[model samples]
Target chain A: MSAPAASLDAVRPPVRTIGRDGRRRLLAAGLVAPLAAFLLFAFAAPIIWILGYGVADNELASVWPRVSAELRDGGDELPPDEAVFAALAADLRGSQASRTAATAARRLNYALPGGRSLVTQTARALADRQEPDPGGGWRETLIALDPAWGERETWVALRQASGPVSAFFLLSAADLRLGADGLERAPPEQRIYLAVLWRTFAVAATVTAAAIVLGFPVAYFLANGPPALASVAMVLVLLPLWTSLLVRTGAWVVLLQDQGLVNGALMALGLTSEPVRLLFNRTGLTIAMVHISLPYLILPLYATMTTIRPELVKAARSLGASPAVAFWRVYLPQTLPGLAAGALLVFILSLGYYITPALVGGAGDQLVSYFIAFYTTETFNWGMAGALAILLVAATAILYVFYARLAGPRGLSLG
Target chain B: MTARRTMRAVSAALAGALLAAPALAQDSVTVVSWGGAYQDAQREVFFRPFEEETGIRVNEETWEGGIGAIRARLASGGDPGWDVVQVEAADILLGCEEGLFEPIDWDRLGGEDSVIPGAAQECGVGAILFNEGIAYDRDALPEGPTGWADFFDTERFPGKRALRMHPAVALMGALMADGVPKEEVTAVLATPEGEERAFAKLETIRDDLIFWRAGAQPPQLLASGEVVMTTVYNGRIDAANREEGRNFAFVWDGSVGSFDYWVILAGTPRIEQAYAFLEYIHRPEVQARLPDAIAYGVVHREAADDIDPERLPDVPSAPENLAVSVTQDLEFWLENAERLTERLQSWAGQ
Candidate 1:
């Protein structure tokens, strides 16, 4: 074999002399350049921007950098000197005139609720002033304007909020907070995010499992059946994919409601006496999510299954192996790559599922994405939203790594 | 290939020029509001008329209620999209204090006293009065729900109840259902025991409750019989009855009346145009046209006379309806919304 290859290579044209290899490599790179740049800007940039919010604490730092620096140098304990106060007064005065006092006030309010008015009122009072006198009665003036300025907690909150990076959002995401003594578990009332995270994972996992169980059989049938029948089946499987997820979810809502088609049929057939509460609960969420995710699982599985030859299973069966044993050992092993790919795809997609769950699922069935949406669109807490999103992405990445390790490199491909 | 490339370039430039064409003309003001009939009414009563009176075009946009979009826009630094926004009272208060909105010149748009009492704020002019009230499908539940108490009384009006998935109105409903007087709802919500009492009252009907976040959901829920009764915006229920031929009746007792205000974004070039639109809507005649168009109440007190007397009962600010309704305390919501929402979410998830 080596001698024949060598002889063949010796007879081949000297394409290397024309710089063909470099030109081919250059062409490949050039072809992918647009895609790579697109991915960088559209995908990686947004992820970096969102992840950056986890540590990017600038709302207060931008306005009162001097006060923040002083607070950081003086430690967590509130400083008694008028330097911090003077810095705050000067920042407030500048911010007020520039119309950015509200942003600073809002930032402070996040740290200490109602801190907004205190800052805004003080800023308005001092809007006419240009400078903060170090020796002057600025402290008394500030204290008189808002008694909160005299408090130590207020100072601590201000210092904590004014930072280049803080674990406030990340810790809050984990239902932990940075207390006086450092990181501690949030109070029971505040410990909601952890449960939401767990619920999100649980819902995603259940949907993935359901997709696998329901999709595998259909994919197998499509792969092994007669070509004409298989083509028709494939079209049926892809039909749901053609419809919008919202429209499909809405269809499910109509089909599963109390007086809807499903219940109406069930009653007509004498299957049950009463209409089951099926639309806004865990059952409804699982059904809708599994339906939405089935195509993701089926396409990949079908792709892998089609590659498996019938002769392999026949060969095993002819060797006196039982049909189930032969199929499991020969056919199932071949489809492992597809199964892993499909499961992971379904899992990842389901993890970020929002619309179907929001529309069909009850309040208890809501996932972390719901809260992320609430914070992002309803409360405008980008820090909290970013933190939750980062947690979700990290969780998905970790899951992918774990799946990759289990499936090996070849199994990672979606056929 | 070169010819095609040049063609592409020429077309791109032409498209760009076409896009920038509007920039040279009279400036257009972007007005954001809750979409559907409400926006339609505003377009008919305010936007078109304002545009006709002044050559400044009014660009209409729709937003589901929240200050988050405005905050996101502002956070990105420059221009916050819409010039004039329709905001809830609590959001307006918060946005005004934070300077997200430009302070209204009450003098220009009829003095503070000229608008309905409590409708005028430092940065917002009250546009319309909307109510969150019990709405029941008359055909579904013949013995319809009368108020929050009847809503909570499942034995009397037994069905799945849809409530707004928020702390403010939900808590108030719970308190009223628990027999707390309308005036004392906020005072009771202020105390820990009051909060606990409200939650406990809510707990009784927790299993039968289906929560809706958007204003559009409640009427749909009622019409589909998915929920026999639900807390819905007064105008939405009215629209459903009028348009869909659904016999949905609103229960005014224990209804929470909240005002939607027209707020000007802080740093928009069309601030003058936004103020002009706001002033135009503040006119009694323009305010009166709103009720006939959408069945929502006008904030201008004198506009009541201009409204059809036969349609008065349907308006949220109607004398009979207003008598039984509790005005939502925007201040209380502004201060406690965060804490209460967190608690509400935790409870809801459980």
Candidate 2:
């Protein structure tokens, strides 16, 4: 009987052996190809272009490779004396004008009182048809324009201003710069952007923490309530999401402004004799952002929490654990996944917010997005914008990694 | 059935081509310009007549924010989307700097003398109307202040006054208020001391001031009584006064005059069409209609012949209206824009 069974199995040769593998391979390819293609074309390609724009040495694309090659070939030493003058002549009077030179001029003109004259003179000399000999032309040009031009400080200032994807923008975000001697130093008068960055992070974290603390209890109540009550709570949760974000932010502005509804009510109630300055302040910003971001935190948590079984908690209670004990031991453990997810979601969203802050907050309350927008739109500085974007993307990825490590898989309990 | 469907499709194609042949024969053109009265006047007089005479279709695309969108498209290494862009001189200056637009071929368009002297130039051709000046609610201050200084005098005026947020307008207004003569506006703006002085005066009124970022905002603020006085576009204030019957009126004294021009983007596929659009829009009849309709001054001084001179004062097209206005220093503004704007925002923060 065993032999017959073995023979029968062998005859059958395991169902769908050859065709199944082929179909499975085809199915996998079908599932993944579109996503990969979309990422490659839409996201990766443009980002690569932006990165390339940031790194490119000059307007003429070919100059980038030649400059990079020259930098690599020179190693640690400065170019030879002959090569230096040749380079200076080529850089100044070459057929293709340096975009960096233009950017440098623009930036310097902003900083120094007499910088515009130096820039225009340099530009005119470079653009002029009368060519000076390579021997002392650069020296003469440097001396005629600025005595300080020979010093590395001048070049460093020019580089900081021009910033063709140099680490300067990333450094500027931190209020730091490469000094005359090539060491990283704090910005002028020893001012550091660390405080601003810290202030920003603190605000974002506070907003996120507030949203989560407020959202979790509400989401828990909604998730554990009776079906009819849960449905009503769900509607209430979704109500803000349906309203326009701008409209909601505007409503907050109306409520928070010194002479607005909330202040008027407070004053009328004799809560304060003078109208408290509510609009264009930190308190108003926090209140508005929390209201705006509350739904984002709550909705995700609610979705995650509702999936947890009530039977597990009931079983714990039946086994002689108190209600609070059962909740702490069973229900709370299951909601960890939701808590972790909500915190991260709210934190990331809050960091990139632009409109809410601009409308409701004062000048000092502006986030990093405001600076990014200023660079991109007002100054038309794509290189700095691209670098800033890259830094932001790096920060977000690092945060995600940090979050993932903190919330280990075991921390996520499900029914 | 499929064969029959194919046959139907072929016949449809044939029908379309047959119908389109006359339009093609006439050298059809399409222009993309700002929507509303400006576009309507262009359609009624220039485009319609041009089509009648030249047999060009003269289609139009109407939208606001045309220049910025076109520049972005050009920067993306794509073909410029607009055949013709009706933009102001300042926008043209920006476009020229970015290399996003081509210089107009004045030899081909050929209205060098017909265009207001100093209007026809390399980047664009002055198409329709100029705008300048300050407007105020007459009811709020019945005495009617004339120059920028009186405009800034809150003690005399005793109400909220609005100004444009742009440094070009703000700096000029500030200096003029601070006793720099109208002729010396540009010279003052060029110096570091002048900018500082202007900022100093502005700092005093910063609390009472509301800076408007858009063309329409100042007029709106004036009409709503949110501001009792403001520096406004001449036509916009006029239109608001007419529509809302507001007590506001404009003072051309110490106003920086600017003309909006019609330009073609550098890499536009339809150059001939764009030229046709420009040529059509500048016709005197078309130019005349726009001032009454849109409230902008027409570039063609001859266009005012159609409208009564009494009405022309109300319209921007009047030469008397144009005479009192000061032209802005475009090159200086272009050179220092980034620094000035950043400084303005930073100073405002303080």
Candidate 3:
């Protein structure tokens, strides 16, 4: 160690002598540090916080700690002792007197339907009477107030709801639930999230595919055409992006309605006797989404396609290769990086679409983001919303990893 | 070293100024309600008058109906910004029980007997009475729908229908269409068989149904001929007819009436000012002026006595209209909304 240190000291610069490269590196990092810190706090912190809601169990635990503790200790079976009932009585009376019974009731309702009324009613009934007679009558009184108290499912739900963290929300997001035995598929009628997730992906994939097919020709023309025409075409491509998404979707609604311009033109030409059902369906959703997402696909492809020299194709042709073979082997493979970037961007954006589908699409056409908004805004189910959001983020990340694997190292650069 | 210190001092002052701006502006009471024509009417009839009379600046904001925004604001463990919020009956009950709202003293505004029956609650005061009813474009459906049953008779009506997406009013309408009596609707809905029966009845018109989420969409749907008939907020149809000259006819039979109430958030610092504004809006004369401005029914019974006889029929709380219309069972909805909404969403997806 002493020999190596002596050699390093011999080669090192004198003390307090700073080099140009070292100074530049320090300045660059100093300039970027604020932005990095801002992103960590502003972007990453909120995401991590929201993701934490999926595993939060404070609502039930905070309001009815005694009952929750008893339930947790009782395990899977219904507690045979009357002490559980006394604890529940005390908790309910406490919550009712404080007017916080609804919080605990709402938490339990997530597990058992109608548990809100069962809890609130029992609390109100007990609130009217004295402290349970300190006897076996407490159980009978609770059952008499709400017969649901006697049900095993109620006890099961109570036990499940008492948690520091549980897999209930994550399982619910996948349309599964924890039963007495183990995790099982949710009832067929309640199996909605899986189907909704599939539809979200299906709609996003269709939009991405349509955007690519329609955008490629336009982007190619702009890339290869004269400068003036290219500028005009570029402006035309970007004009819709400048407009509000609501306005663009509204324009589609106006044009695709039964009595709208398209239908009027169709009937005027005697194409059909009746107006077609064009709006408020999957067809309307795809058309509108493609129009909205086309610019994303076009810009990236245009950037890449314009960089491909015309002489490359000419050189291939000079080697006696047919035009089709040369174009297929040389041109298409060169554009894969841009294609990957554009497809990933459009697909990720489409997966979180909320407004366009809610306005233009039919009831069944609504996506998972719509459900996220529903749970967050309408029902105030933050846990469910967080779980669904995590699923979406994870899904997008997985897709990105796959794209990266397919596109190789150069794929990171969108251009 | 001096330059760096100065830079730090300036940035600190700027941050402190940013933080102090909102604190200095806290004298005004923020009022939140449904936007569009509804908020416009409140601004004209309630907010402007209250500000003029009380000298307290009123900051008006708009929100679409739901307690989610309120819950979000309160979740941050600080003042929830708004002093008063307009909420529906079910939400008022739920929010009150959850301790999200302050218990209102009805005697301060008027005695308990002064407010309309079923409108007074422990933590909220009824602001308006509204109904959800079938409406049709006069030019398109001249015969018009007579009742909910006619709404379901696609064979005779022979056109698409727009219904609200939620289960509360829609399920009640479905049960009514299936010939269940008004008083028995809640009882019937309590059973699984009743729910199945309602869904089965709705299935007959599934192909013809276009579900709408917002109150404003129904009139637009009817105007654009997207649907021949829709269940719309009675006030929206009235406003469209009066303002746009759209000849839309309302079917009052089988209509379901409910109330929207004003409640103060539990942790608001402006409780006295909030109560004053609430008191001001509930004045008999102020309530009377509201019908002409927004076309919604008022909860002050005496306010109805002040309206012109010609305009009284448009009010949902008119004695004749109330006789035919069913009052919404708020307790039932508050208890069952979570489960029923999930079921409704699943059904819509199917």
lDDT of 1 by residue, A1-415 (tens): 7999888778877686358888988999999999999999999998899888876777788877777777777754563477778888888888877677767877777666577667778888898976544555678778877888887768767777878878777887888875545567876765788888889889989998989899999999999988999999999999999999989998898898899998999999999999988988999999999999998899999999989999999999999999999988888999988888899889888888888888889988888888888877777778888898888888878878887888899778865
Comparing 2 and 3 on DockQ, the stronger one: 3
Docking class of 1: acceptable
How far in Å is the alpha carbon of A215 misplaced in model 1?
1.1
Which residue pairs in candidate 3 collide?
A: none
What's the DockQ for every one of the candidates? 0.32, 0.10, 0.47
Model 1: how far is A345 from its true place, Å? Answer: 0.5
True contacts kept of each: 0.40, 0.05, 0.70
User: What's the TM-score of each model vs. the native?
Assistant: 0.88, 0.74, 0.88
Residue by residue across B1-350, what tens digits does model 3's lDDT show?
Answer: 23543564366446545554443344578998989878998898788766655656799888887766677788886788888999978699888887788999888988778877778889999989999999999998788889989999988999889888888778988999999998898899989899898888888898998888878789989999989999999988998999999999888888888899999998998898898788878877668777877778888877776665778899886777777888878887877776777777788778
Candidate 2 per-residue lDDT over residues B187-240, each given as its tens digit: 988887898898888877776675554476676566545566788888777777
Which lDDT value does model 3 have at B220?
89
Q: What would the DockQ be for model 1?
A: 0.32
Q: What is the per-residue lDDT of model 1 for residues B116-227, given as tens digits with 9 covering 90 to 100?
A: 6668889988878888889987887787878888888988877899888888879999999998999899999988899999999999999899988778778878877898
